[model samples]
Target chain A: MAFGKDHELHQRRFGRNLWVGACLLGFVAIVFGLTVVKVTRDGPIEGFDHTVRPQMTEGAK
Target chain B: MTDTSILPPQSGEAGFGDYFALLKPRVMSLVVFTALVGLLVAPVPVHPMVAFASVLFIAIGAGASGALNMWWDADIDQIMKRTKGRPVPSGRVTPGEALQIGMWLSCFAVVMLLLSANPVAAGLLAFTIFFYAVVYTMWLKRWTPQNIVIGGAAGAFPPMIGWAVATGGVSVESVLMFALIFMWTPPHFWALALFMKSDYADAGVPMLTVTHGRRETRRQILIYTLILVPVALGTGLTSIGGPLYMAVALVLNLAFLKGAVDIWRRKEEEAEADGYAVEKKVFRLSLYYLFLHFGALLAQAVLRVYGIGGW
Candidate 1:
């Protein structure tokens, strides 16, 4: 019961702070996740721009 | 009480959490955000693994600075209500232990970054650690009301270091990012000082609110906010940002300026009578102000790849 009383007091004073902190952390995690997605999806674009091929001669055909 | 009794009893029972608290996670978060923005906006591409390593090492360096700051400020921190429960002051960690941890991490982070990235980033990281721990914490904090103004440079270096990691050098774009955070620090911190003046006074910290009084602190907050708007917008004008960033910057700066003006126009008596509502609002808005500005910069980077703006 004593522990409960202390916990309740802490919840009263810092509940909002804790909630906001969690929300901010969650938001950051989501943003980082999205960044990973974007990076992976666009990874080939740079390589595509730089890729080169050699042409075969008609004698080889 | 004699001087001997005034000292905390020496104990060597620090836990993991106590050591983590020494890192100042909140400050680390801001460093990580700005550094990530710098990495994203750099002209040269960095490998994903290398980018991750660079940011991690940068975060560790920021943590090292925080630990050193806590070690140096422990005396004042013990007297301040807001800081009384911190690991050092609460006796969870010894000042000597904190100093050792900070110095060790500072070396480790800088060396690891140098091996992973380049010497430019490592050197900047070393300077940032020294600036925050020595210049800001040891010197400026106890001496002047303009402490936060000059001390803010340490916090402003992350983005530049990040840019260096990617490009292996500094550029105008990174400097703009640095300016944005530097100019924003005063208003952001002074708004908090407006509400927490008594804490600084009790600790003999000589924050602006304690030295110049609340009215002047509020006015300075407004002045800094005015300066911050143009700097935030200027980031958009750089090669790193685009039209999307410009639009976001315009709207955010307008709202921020309005909030600053509201804080400025209110009389002290009115603010006190209203439970310091205006100061609290400004403080909360300042958090979102930085986040939104940086978030828009990241958005502009993404849009540029799609050919929306940065062509």
Candidate 2:
């Protein structure tokens, strides 16, 4: 069986789709890496959640 | 299944490159480089990953504003020969698409920056987007000849944001870096206006060349260049500066001042006869002026790692 050739328009669409996929993957990887670094590194993570926590209030005491 | 052969060809459809072009990658590059220098030169150390992520977000923020600028300026862009072929003006992308992309990316970049870096950097990035897209593009650009002089602030903020990323606040060094770009902007742009002929005039944008005439623009270029010399040299005395930086600053400033004086001294008839050679030369040197200054700073930073960069 012979395969049909892809048109220029189809090729362009494919290229665009590929870039979009790559960008999404890259963004995900960057976010994951940032999260890992932030969590594993040493310092007080100042996340706010309405409820008072001991570590957050330690300076006041 | 539909036959592939039956699908209609859309010749005008925009591809990924067109969308990327909408982001003004060239401007984004300046943003990335300056911001990276800002991040590295700070006294406080940043994690490699955090620094990378923060700069990436800053570039994205700069790009988002670029897209928005293209969207707003599409009308004038179509008129200006230099910008007539941009994505929106060329009919490759819709204004609505550009707007949505810019808005979405603007939010994403700011929020991501906050998560990856600090609030100060993120806040500055948000403010930069607003300043470029709204204050400069919408308001100042059409209204005054001093548009670029003031709009230059938007471009100057990246380094400051980078410094804030590392230090979580601004300082003299960062402010000097900001001032360097801010002061450099007028002379750089005015030189281009001197050379580029009627593009700005035809576009209805009130460039100094259009509003104040070429002579005044040249005089203004000299004035700004004079003001720029002190700021450029002042940066070399800051904590980020070293003997190497000071030498580089002195040499570069002399060349820059000479270029500005050459531009100021030329008559309109002389420029028109020689295709604005002096103005073009100054424009070319201006590119190196910024790059070398930043490169010297980065070199000083690297040398500091080995115990001998700054005074």
Candidate 3:
């Protein structure tokens, strides 16, 4: 909506828009990169254990 | 900055920081903190990366809602001194730009959240964005005196969203977290309404203080705060609760009740004479009240990590 306008606020917002978009994409990249690296057979990087089997309740079959 | 009172932003006036102002960073910070607490306190532990991603996207979703709120409320904002300096109202950013930012960010946050977390969590996040932007901002806000009461749901949904991100479904724990914010919202906002009387009146928003008299509003504040006490303390009885949380909740609720009582007993003339100092104090306490409650919840989670706290 503000593409054609050439005011200082508009220009400033446009510049910020680029930086914010870039930063968001960068964050996504970092997250996905970490996800892929952490999804290995060995398990996640921070030692988040997803390997525990659920213990059955008492009197189970 | 040159006055763009009748026109668009003046040339060479606003900076990049002005665009960030539209995000309502203060509100987003609260959402991030509470959502983090929710995720931390969940029964199911999540991957650290996933937890980070979920909180980040939820914060983005909050910012998106803020942008849209600024867009929709620009008119009322321009009328009220409290909001006159907002990006849209101040001519630092146009309404169209605000809408564009809001829509794009909302979609990005929801989609990224889906990628980072499960569908249930992402869906709730999407619904939260929609509720805050479309449901509350566009529909309910201008239409009813009960707006804050109902619209508070938009703010209340974060902890639920966080819990969903962790567990991939709703549960009583999550509902209680939602209830904590939902019930507290009325009194929290009504306190502000009591102090900032002219802002809503000038903006034509049907705040409790505007529709009902301040006496009734103060009475309602006491009533809601009375009700809010149990909900705050109720968390202590849940699995998330512990001795520390119970202790904190007990003292906070008593002090909060006293604050409400103090406000309830005051006459308008006395309030005006004191420059609404008591009202302002209560408003500040409300901020700390929520913050401390959530902080206690987070503390319980930390203790649980050491295998100590939580029943």
Query: Largest DockQ belongs to which candidate?
Result: 2
lDDT of 2 by residue, B217-247 (tens): 9999999999999999999999999999999
- Candidate 1 accuracy as lDDT: 0.82
Candidate 3 chain B minimal-lDDT segment of 10 residues: B1-10
Give the best candidate by lDDT: 2
Which residue pairs clash in candidate 2? none
lDDT of each: 0.82, 0.91, 0.85
Which residue ranges in model 1 land beyond 4 Å of their true spot? A1-61, B1-5, B10-12
- Which pairs of residues collide in model 1? none
lDDT tens readout by residue for model 1, B105-138: 9998899789778999999999999999988888
lDDT of 3 by residue, A4-28 (tens): 7586657767887888788869886
By DockQ rank, best first, the candidates go 2, 3, 1
Report per-candidate TM-score of chain A alone.
0.51, 0.63, 0.57
Q: lDDT tens string, model 3, B1-311?
A: 11235434633545667767888999999899889989989999887877888898999999999998888888788778878888887787877778898999999899988888889988999998899888888888877878998888889999999999889999888888898899889888888888774767666677777778889999999998988898888889999899999999999899899999999999999999999999999989999999999999999989989999777
lDDT of 3 at B107: 93
Ranking by TM-score: 2, 3, 1
